[model samples]
Target: MAKARILIVDDSPTEMYKLTAMLEKSGYEVLKAHDGAGGVALARQEKPDAVLMDIVMPGLNGFQATRQLSKDQETAGIPVIIVTTKDQETDKVWGTRQGARDYLTKPVDEDTLLKTLALVLRG
Candidate 1:
């Protein structure tokens, strides 16, 4: 079977490394972007199976990026999972409103993240 392709967008190198390592360990092919603009571009170009997006960044925030991706015809079907430090009901609701398939808080637990990924990809 082909490994799932995941695009991770975050400015934090450490977080990117950690998530990349976790995804790779679980047999995924990873793509990366450091900001929201780049994330959108990568999503359009790669059409990854799923995207892991950060809420805050220099260029564009995750919400805006997710909105753009969800609206675009070419990338609309790609599932986005917001992974960020914002851990509030409002934030989660907003992320979902932006068309994210799932929302995960920072310091994300490995099992939960993986399970969410599997669920989104399966659907």
Candidate 2:
């Protein structure tokens, strides 16, 4: 089977490097975007299997990007997982409302991230 391609949208270079290294080590193909607008454009063009989105970014935030993807016919089926520093209960709820399949906070646990990713991909 082909490895899943995961698009990671975050403005932080350190976070991007960390996530890319982790996902690559697990044999998943990683696509990167520096901010939400670029992420949305990439997602639309590439149609990656899943998206890992960060909430706080310049231009289009993750929530808006997720909403756009979820509502658009071409991208609606693609699952988005919000990966952000926002850890409040309300933030979680808002992420779900924006159509994220799952939510993970910054300093994410590698195991939890992989597990949640596997689960979402399974569905």
Clash pairs, model 1 backbone: none
Candidate 2, backbone clash total: 0
Clashes of each: 0, 0
24, model 1: CA deviation in Å? Answer: 0.3
List CA RMSD, all candidates. 0.5, 0.5
Whole-model Cα lDDT of every candidate shown, in order: 0.97, 0.96
Candidate 1: worst-modelled 10 consecutive residues by lDDT: 104-113
Clashes by residue pair, model 2: none
- Candidate 1's displacement at residue 98, Å, is 0.5
lDDT tens digits, residue span 45-90, model 2:
9999999999999999999999999999999999999999999999
Candidate 1 C-alpha error for residue 42, in Å:
0.5
* TM-scores, one per candidate: 0.99, 0.99
Off by over 4 Å in 2: none
